[model samples]
Target: MNYWILSIEAIMNTFSIIESKSDIRFKMSLDSTSERGNILDEQSINAGDKILVFIDKPVGEIRYMLEVTGVDHTHLVLHKSYETGYGLTMRKMQQVDEETYNLLESNNHRQLHQISEASFNTLFSHMFEDFSNRYEVKTEQPVIHETKEDYVAPEKNPQDEHLPHNWIVFGAPGTGKSYQIDQQRKTYFGSNYERVTFHPNFSYGQFVGAYKPRPMKEDKSKITYDLVAGPLLRTVTKAMNHPERNYVLIIEEINRANTAAVFGDIFQLLDRNEDGKSEYNIVASEEVKEYIESQTDADLVNYEIHLPSNLYIWATMNTSDQGVFPLDSAFKRRFDFEFISINASEEKIGDIDITIKGIGTMKWNHFRRTLNDYLLQHVRNIKEDKLIGPFFIKKTDLEASDKHFQKVFQNKLLMYLAEDILKTDKTKLFKYPSFSQIVTAYIEDEENVFSDAFTEALAEQE
Candidate 1:
């Protein structure tokens, strides 16, 4: 049976009603009648598919599991309300398997929690207490036999679906580039990806493979060094063995380390052909060759290995990060860079009260928007990179008292301003003579006083 993924937006109104009433029926609008022409149509939704229901922001979680029982032009009905909450703008839906569902559930329903056909079948089989009603069982089988003559699976668009083998997501800090990669990892690799963060001291041995000391089994006092493969080598080996499935290796803050030094000879493998396979299949060093042979059962007589076409290497870079190791043109040419821009969505946090020490209770979203706007207009040389993302301050952070706000400002906002924004011209940026004075004014003054101070500073500059 074919599987699909579907999403639905659950607004507050619908979510509250469903939670209290236990109603499983909802309306799902189709683009046109032709869109629902046949069960086999590209846009046609069918019964027995699994659903991962998502609620609106502030309520951001998969609240329900639903099995589609029926679908019509105006509405879709579920056989059982596995979970609850439906309200708002749009919901993402997808077909998944029992394995995938279990994996998703284990991850706190955080990532890919879409329903699978296998899960639906299991849900359907045990739904009834007794099997005496044979006729009822026969009638309820969700086999889709109808097919339209014009129905065809849509052609894959390279720009939309296909990701380059080596790509870098570059953006201002907190622009959700890593979040995007995390979501894509769930979509493509499921739970089978390795993530590593690069730092100033990261080395080739730590990345590719390294010989580490371990105590000998025979003698407690004696120790032996063993070659252990790092994230890159392990992921590469896994990809080589399972060529049919895609494997991903995510390098977070790739520019934080010396790119050339961290990669060493493995850098050559970044050069790929049109088909995405490594162009120069280089032989391994004797140490690495022997290590590979010893570690795996697969024969490697030639001592040569190439990065498989299915192995995806993804990295993230912050535009404003300081002391980034530069990548040469040859290394840079191998990657496709996608820039993430600042999001201007006016999403606010709800159901929580956050009161700063000197400031009265205020909406977290309003405070963020106000601060960002003030910084942009008043602070000299401030850019989008210096602004904070909407999700930077989470719900949990607001649960605490003034301490949370203080910690956030000192660690995140003030640090950014000091290191990046006010480094060159502190006097031009703020009314205060020093960074400490500006921070003191921000903390000690009332909310309105602080805002007015910023405005007065801007006015003085004008």
Candidate 2:
């Protein structure tokens, strides 16, 4: 395993954010998908590497250390924060911990620097520590259901929360339905879930398996067609091969694609038996059977695909998008659904405020609630679905600065209102008749860019 030190500079508030939220983010010169001449792939840093976090300020020192659970472009998310970490002085580390000192000295002012694994192990005295990737085997432990109603599991992790066999979380845009799924799944299970987003062109062949052309191993000029597995098939194969464990399949934007066409005959397998196994089996074609055989070492069984009881499929549906396929009653019946209100994810927005130097400053939540209220009362034919959620803009963007907030507000919210929500009657929502006027008002007007009624509503609320 590789080790690295991530130096956090600039912005004092982010340290508390990272520590309180137990998630770290760093701006990198190169993205996760970027490639260079020196490293493997585009980024040398990967998911399994250990990271030593250093706070850059009056006294530069390494504080907490954590494992990189994921590498999302410029962000490095961990399973959880290192929790309680003692601050270590560079001088002490240099004398006592030479491995860490070497990396710190050679970092050369770079944000990220590789360190020796020996230095990492010397910092901690845990026995189960090794490079075996503990996150893999422990990710999302599935609770296997038995035919007996009272069948109890012998060994259960206390943190493991039982999940629904077939479930869907639906909500308006930015309502944190996906965030809810992600956070809850990580808490109940390990941080080892795979998610797939459906789009207009997403097809069954892409979701499941299909025969595709490939170059012959011995002859570059010759071609052959073989069955290739998709995300669902790969996940299902893994779950089926290891039935003792539970698995989860997360589908985002379930209605973006033609659900009926995408699921095809596999829809029959959505019905589950009492034990969570699929009530019916999908008849596997010869190529599918061959592919399954080649991919897995499962014991002898018929050439059929079935959903095991331990396999759970959870999906998210956005209720506020256009040009999206509708889920039929028959398809919808297979899963239980939960709806998230716009206010459900309000805490994420916090009490941060937006301020303009020459104009006025308003609490972020106050602005959101006031705007939503005004929209509901004043905007003709505008539904709650069209109203902005608590998380329409992230907390960071809200606190970025007056200019940045103004630009973001003008570019995103105002544009959304003019084009999408208030297109029926622009005068009902925005102060300006034209889009450019609306943007210009946000940039220059001191009274605010929203309709007079919205502005008055904000005043009354404040």
Best by lDDT: 2
Question: Total clashes, candidate 2?
Answer: 4
- Model 1: weakest 10-residue lDDT segment is 84-93
Cα lDDT tens digits, model 2, 409-453, are 778877887888876678886667788787776667655656667
Error of 1 at 11 (Å): 54
- Local error of candidate 1 at 17, Å? 62
TM for candidate 2 is: 0.63
Q: Supply candidate 1's per-residue lDDT for 324.
A: 77
Look at candidate 2 and tell me the lDDT of residue 189: 41
lDDT of 2 at 402: 68
For 1-462, candidate 1 gives per-residue lDDT tens digits of 344333333223332222211335766444333323212232445676655454434343344445667666567675434321112111121132335333433432112223356654443332221111212222121212114643232233222467798989977665677888887776667645778999765556568765443446677455444555678888877766666667778999999877876777778899988777899877785666765666556666787878888888999987577767777888899899988765533243445555644445666555665666777876867667667665566545666667776787566765666657767666543555566776777767633324356545434443
